[model samples]
Target: MRLAPLDGGEDAETKPLWQRLGWMVAIWLVSVTALGAVAYLLRLWLA
Candidate 1:
């Protein structure tokens, strides 16, 4: 059987390197901010 690309398709490869990196950084920032907010709220609840 054949396997699909990890990124879902060729669209990710078609984009420029900087654009891809920018998207990754943006996603990482959003994820970190969300986790931090959750942790802060949990701390407030437990304290």
Candidate 2:
């Protein structure tokens, strides 16, 4: 016997606007942190 999953593979558009904004903010935060770490390391090595 097979059971269907809830929401059934819905499209991203179905998510509320706030949820999308949350994901964008999280990704941007991660990117900024990574860049800052890289810049700091380079400055330390070059100095």
Candidate 3:
């Protein structure tokens, strides 16, 4: 598959609302979990 450059933001209105929200929530959860892991490791290293 040929990869193309981002063509700006895709129109949100074109996608189903549930699909967009699901992606948002999934990404948010992943980011939060990664941050928590980093904080935990730092705390352990500093103790």
Model number with the top lDDT = 1
Worst 10 residues of 3 by lDDT: 1-10
State in Å the error of residue 33, model 1: 0.3
Reference-based lDDT, each prediction:
0.92, 0.89, 0.88
Ranking by lDDT: 1, 2, 3
Pairs clashing within candidate 3: none
> Residues 1-47, candidate 1, lDDT per residue (tens digit)?
65766556678779999999999999999999999999999999999
Better of 2 and 3 by lDDT: 2
Q: How does residue 22 of candidate 3 score in lDDT? A: 100
lDDT per residue for candidate 2 within 7-44, as digits (tens), equals: 45576768998998999999999999999999999999
Once fitted onto the true fold, the runs of candidate 2 whose alpha carbons sit more than 4 angstroms away are 1-10
Ranking by TM-score: 1, 2, 3
Q: Evaluate model 3: give its lDDT.
A: 0.88
Q: How much does candidate 2 score in TM-score?
A: 0.75
What residue runs in model 3 are displaced by over 4 Å at the alpha carbon? 1-11
Each prediction's TM-score against the native?
Answer: 0.75, 0.75, 0.72
